[model samples]
Target: MSWEESYHGRLRAMAGDEEVLIMVGARCLLRDDQGRLLLIRRSDNGLWACPAGGLELGDSIRECAVREAWEETGLTPTELAPIAILSGADTVGTNQWGHTYQFHITVFLATAWTGELVTETDETTDAGWFHPDQLPSPRTANVEKSLALLAEYDRTGVFVAP
Candidate 1:
């Protein structure tokens, strides 16, 4: 089972379905040598997003970022630098199983990586690299925010919060 299913299942069993759960996760803004950004089309929502997922037990945020990127996009991150920490009521959502969750998502920039890009059939339907100016339409809110932060980071060497 995935981390979400395992954790949500355990929580539901312990606290009942009405309890709101807080999930910590990480996302990687993977860039190729040519400076193209990597994006994955999620199987569940059919929306393009950065490679990301909830932290599994015993995994650090950096490890989570690396693992999620590899799992979803077949890339092995060699270096990761944190870019932003996004949280708040706006990050709250419900899964397909009707379990409510609040997310604390740490966004990371992978400075170096290597792998053949292939989408994980279970999680993503497609994966590709795109120039920032030519990004796919209708990206997730977090992805849009990450892209903005990435630009700001590139320009100023620091991520400025909005």
Candidate 2:
């Protein structure tokens, strides 16, 4: 079953012409002192992924990441440390809408966290902290990339390069 059959959501971004490209989204890398990152089991596909979602209208990309993180994990990130800017063809949700050209995503390393992680949200079912090496069992491709980016940031503290 494709993402389209799994999720009834839409992805639209201001690219070119009048058509809104429905492929852009954001992902957040929240890590703790133990080097564990936050992950949410998506309610729609049961796949583990970083606390992330699509960018809505009238929302800055940074704000969108923060909002999606909070909504999905029920935790507030205090700071946003730039990690890596990922650009590539991405299939938003469960839809196979002919992967769009490089969905510009700004990955971040959030060290400070507040509130409690809850599973009472509609978007996410389960939430937990896992070591980078011991990530979840069923994580999305983007989740894997996000984890790699986090490790890269940890090693160099530089987000631009690999």
Best by lDDT: 1
Q: Cα deviation in Å at residue 143, candidate 1?
A: 1.5
* Per-residue lDDT of model 2, residues 102-159, tens digit only: 3567777788978888975888779898887787778779877776677677688786
Top-TM-score structure, candidate number: 1
Q: Count the backbone clashes (under 3 Å) in each candidate.
A: 0, 6
Worst 10 residues of 1 by lDDT: 1-10
Taking all chains together, each candidate's TM-score versus the true structure is 0.86, 0.77
lDDT of 1 by residue, 16-131 (tens): 66678998989899987788999999988888999998887788999999988999988889988987788899888887767788989888999788888896657999988899
| Candidate 2 Cα errors over 4 Å, as ranges | 1-22, 89-102
- Model 2: lDDT to the true structure: 0.71
Clashing residue pairs in candidate 1, if any? none
